[model samples]
Target: MSSPASGHPSPPRRGPRIAAISATIALFVAMIGIATSTQASAAPGCKVDYSTSNWGGGGFTGSVKITNVGDAITGGWTLRFAFPGSQTISQGWSATWAQSGTGVTATSMSWNGNLGAGASVDIGFNGTYSGTNASPTSFSLNNVTCTGQPGTTTTTTTTTTTTTPGGPGPGNRVDNPYVGAKVYVNPDWSAKAAAESGGSRISNQPTAVWLDRIAAINGTTSARGLVAHLDEAVRQAAGSTLTIQLVIYNLPGRDCSALASNGELGATEIDRYKTEYIDPIAAILGRSAYANLRIVTVVEIDSLPNLITNVSPRPTSTPNCDVMKANGNYVTGVGYALAKLGAVANVYNYIDIGHHGWLGWDDNFGPTAELLYTAANASGSTKANVHGFIANTANYGATTEPYFKVGDTVGGQPIREKAKWIDYNKYVDELSYAQAFRQRAVQAGFDSGVGMLIDTSRNGWGGTARPTGPGPTTSPDAYVDGGRIDRRIHLGNWCNQKGAGLGARPTAAPASGIDAYVWVKPPGESDGASKEIPNEEGKGFDRMCDPTYTGNARNGNSMSGALPDAPLSGAWFSAQFQELMKNAYPAL
Candidate 1:
């Protein structure tokens, strides 16, 4: 939820490269054994080559080689297997990969997809291995089993670790159902909630914390920094019915066009993403103790949507954005996270779909869905991986655009009857946008069982009782006719606007197709600083936060004026927090 609205100036570069791959399968071919396809739907006569490089330290690297021996894999190929070790993928590339317990999957990358009869493509990953790293015995592509030599079989032993839960001193009581349904909260946000109390209703309002990176838990040690955070969530609950929420933000080349919340990783660091970030987080989550808690992971915000909405026909100069498109980073990253975490029973994965103002038009519907479909279908992504999607995250767009309808005609006609900017899809509100996105996603091959989530934390700003008058008139109107939803001086303003109020309270009960309404964006955390203030956190300030900086013409960030009261990217702002509570829709 860090980067706001990003608009790319060019159109998409289409067409596929029809090049043949060579000489890459030798590594797996030399050491692997053969196995037949076990998939019922697989084509006959397919075979696979499986092998593990070795196991050392706390991990080892592994690879899979699939050979299509029958009809061409015209519909694409998916390679699947079972890990015979305590192995977990930290990062995977070349194809989309996912692992749930002992099982793993890798779907073909666009360039390497569709292996011709007798042709093969190789895929591999660096995985964390605690015990024996036995090479898996079998492999299959497109569900047909591959014939190869299975690795050596061995006996195994198991171990368990336990910890006592205790916290929240005298007078602070707690109670809750642990029937394995706890939502772990980040300790940082919990402390912020406490500190913001005192005469502030926000103190009473429950909120989520932002995990923007692989933070140091105890003065720089333990890949288990996430484990430490979850530990805090457990202690804070003190056996209460209250659940915690953690926001896993921070993708390399993060908010492409925006400046404030740019992350530590670059678009090219695919290996670090696996070794340093995803693996440890997966290890902690895979533990049985944390299995019952409801761990809602807001996977890589501000990513995928950029591929469709922020790419340019003129060729983008932004290296990360360019690399992202070329390497399929966003699609791969989200698929990896979904597959990894989705393996856990209690964890819920929700990929972020940018707000209606960003990808709500007719042109956005199909591509956005296809993008989601690709990520969901990536090798490792299981049927259970992406349970739902979250929309309008971190933006201030209202839940319902009451002024427009699906077929409402404008300028004496229904849709596009006047301005070239308008259309007939009626994505005038967040809910309609979500519904339409859900349908397109299904058509694009996502499961119909998928659900939806919306970030309603800041959208409910203008109600009937509220005034279109008395707001910051000098600031740009978010909407067009009169005082509409426009937040800053123009279209696509993402900074803390001058007059925006709080929206609906967090609710498990939202409209249908929506699993629940969530505050994916923690309120009062400045989108970015007013100016570049020297700080330990690398969250830099952009001209978008300047008081007089007109706007970022290159990226179209028109929310130019500084929010006099806001702070930097992840800090708490008392004034803004108070305003949110005072202007709350349910009336804090």
Candidate 2:
């Protein structure tokens, strides 16, 4: 959205900001983006995060995130801020915007009228200022003075600092390093969930610690940070060994072509990723003190998936994903990561195998498997180095669709493992897709020992709300049996959906051929900001996240059964957590 004035270029688009729900609420203003740190007081328990975009022509767009740290606002709430300069909001969306003098108030709209204890919502507006556009110095939520916050944008989490790349942890496999150890929980996520749970606490679950990037990047997990995290984890374990899963998430052009959560590396920065990100990470993991720890690395999420199917609608502007693929960066970069990380003694790696909804079809399945093998067996790596693959990394595919007929044709051909789906025994979930992928991997000459993992963090949409009969597909019994999920409009609905329940609880050795049903993406963290506020992150916004985005052909234009205006990915959304808990599959 550039309003170019003659020869003047548009100011850089604003990246996402960490919404601050700082103190009283379990929510945090966890810093994000390039901005000067300011501590502005709002309501007693709340804080306002501000970021600017397209500042030019005496006008700029500003985004403000209001969070209630004092207990859930339960009803209508208002956010008020005083501009430091001549700045005045002209208009806004996602909230009812109004102004008087230099004072402005943004009242909650009907859809976002309420929030759970630590929940926050993003609302921004285009504004005009005479000379300079300085951010508002203070803010108030519900008229109560909030905290004056000071912070900067960074993705390094405490748990991620202590986590590692690859190896077995609690899967209980014969080769698992932490055979008798419990999966180490990331304290930050646990604490946030615990503080917000209020009485419905989910006990003893493990959260994934993510090594999203290195020092060269703006995030926290560099080699030194990883060592510090590991050192601290070892201290927490006392004399016993601990198991932990670390997501090796920062691939070049991460999320490849998405508007949210894009990485520091461009699609063309392959060489930098190797020397700067991966190599140092590998050196730290090779240290001997960490030998007995169970380190499971979720290699990369959303990267390889694009090579098969562009589940996201981001290739339009950040087309570098295709360029990376053309120059072999996508393959080589991933291969380098697998090989370098795999060389570490205790490292166990799993490449992204997407989910049943994304790559379960015939057209995508084979290429992904081949891509996985090619990445695993690249020039310097052996088939033995790449341990396995993970599916549903940051996705919302149901653990089991329960009743779609196997042979249904979308066009003129049978979908998925058509013959295999007819067996009635196999369910349509990550398990089925994993089994099929494992077969494909072996065919590509990888060892048969390769396993599969599914992040059941957000897919189990249990509760009586689940459908009891057939869905709208032309295929017979697309969702016919009892207890089917019919809420999603198409194959690409990945936001924090409305009726979504907690999938499977984290566990090891759940089934044969499957590694474990893990919780890789933390339960309450967001996937992307609701569409109205604009793509703060360069990754761009997809309507799939806009709860209101009705799907079209490319997105399958399916109706997303999610509530509109969810927060950005990786931020805590108390409302969503409450929904997930109430609807948890095995019943919280």
Best by lDDT: 2
Single out the weakest 10-residue window by summed lDDT for candidate 2.
1-10
Looking at model 2, residue 127 earns an lDDT score of 75
Worst 10 residues of 1 by lDDT: 167-176
Model 2 agreement with the true structure over 1-588: per-residue lDDT tens digits: 010000000112222221111121222332221112352322235556677643325655676666655444444567777887787776565566789888998866433555555677777676777866666666665544443443322332212111122333222334433346677666667767888755236745886776665642223421225676677667767888777677776667766545556665777778888888888888877788887676777877767767655532433224555665667777788788878887776778778777776565545666777888787767477677777788778666676666554433333333332222222222256665675576567667776556778788877877878775545554423423332563454445667677888889887756545667888887777766676455433444556567776754334345755566676556677888888888788777
Q: Distance from true position, residue 161, model 1, in Å?
A: 43
- The number of clashing residue pairs in each candidate reads 45, 31
TM-score of 1: 0.63
For model 1, what is the alpha-carbon lDDT of residue 243? 51
Candidate 1 stretches with Cα past 4 Å from truth are 1-187, 197-199, 216-225, 235-243, 314-319, 403-406, 409-425, 462-480, 483-491, 552-561
